[model samples]
Target: MPYLNAAAVKAQDSPGIISVGVLLLFILIALQILNVLRKILMWWIRLLWWVTVGAVLVLFASIIYQRGPEKTVEDALRGARHLSEVWWREYRRWEGYQNLQQQHHVGTSQKSWTSRW
Candidate 1:
């Protein structure tokens, strides 16, 4: 019963519309400050912008964590990892084939020149 109550509380408190509005408001203010700071500080502003971008990305990720379906996120990450590994293996194989082709071309060219002489 306690666990059920806790789950109910969590479900009820989840961000609906107001929290999203507040998040957007903070983001807008942060962007405006970043623009002004960049104009005043130049390179420092660029560094700040990168930091801001990192923070924003993290915030967006957290928002997704809070809002999105847990199972879907898990499945997506698993699929993404699988795809990346498959792609890397394929890329390495391609590179190996390319190197072999290059070697074959060089060896053939050398043999042809030797035969001509």
Candidate 2:
């Protein structure tokens, strides 16, 4: 009338069942710990990358600040304007000198030709 024999059920070991349950619990705990460690490692890598990018940006800005000609925009513009005016004056002087030289040469050549004739 019963599906299981009472004597056989009583003979089955209980300690083996408990040991299997404990083993599976430990395996699950280990998997959870590994997952947490993987997430932590990914977070650490991202933090390091951002820090490196910040350092590079700071270095570039410092170099530009140190090497720039003028500290202020107004000073830079004024200096550039002064330099352009000086260059323009020098160019006009050079052009006038060139014209005088050409005129002197033409006059000298005309006199030489008339004397030879």
Best by TM-score: 2
Ten residues in sequence with the least summed lDDT for candidate 1: 108-117
Cα TM-score per model: 0.35, 0.41
Runs of candidate 1 with Cα error greater than 4 angstroms are 1-68, 110-117
| Residue 49 Cα positional deviation in candidate 2, in Å, after optimal superposition | 1.5
Write the residue-wise lDDT of candidate 2 on 9-104 in tens digits: 644745676577789999999999999999999999999999999999987678668866355556667889999999999999999999988799
Over 26-79, each residue of candidate 1 has an lDDT whose tens digit, in order, gives: 999999999988787897878999999999999868867876878657877899
Residue pairs that clash (backbone atoms under 3 angstroms), model 1: none
Cα misplacement distance, residue 108 of candidate 1 (Å): 2.1
RMSD of 1: 27.2
Q: Backbone clash tally for model 1? A: 0
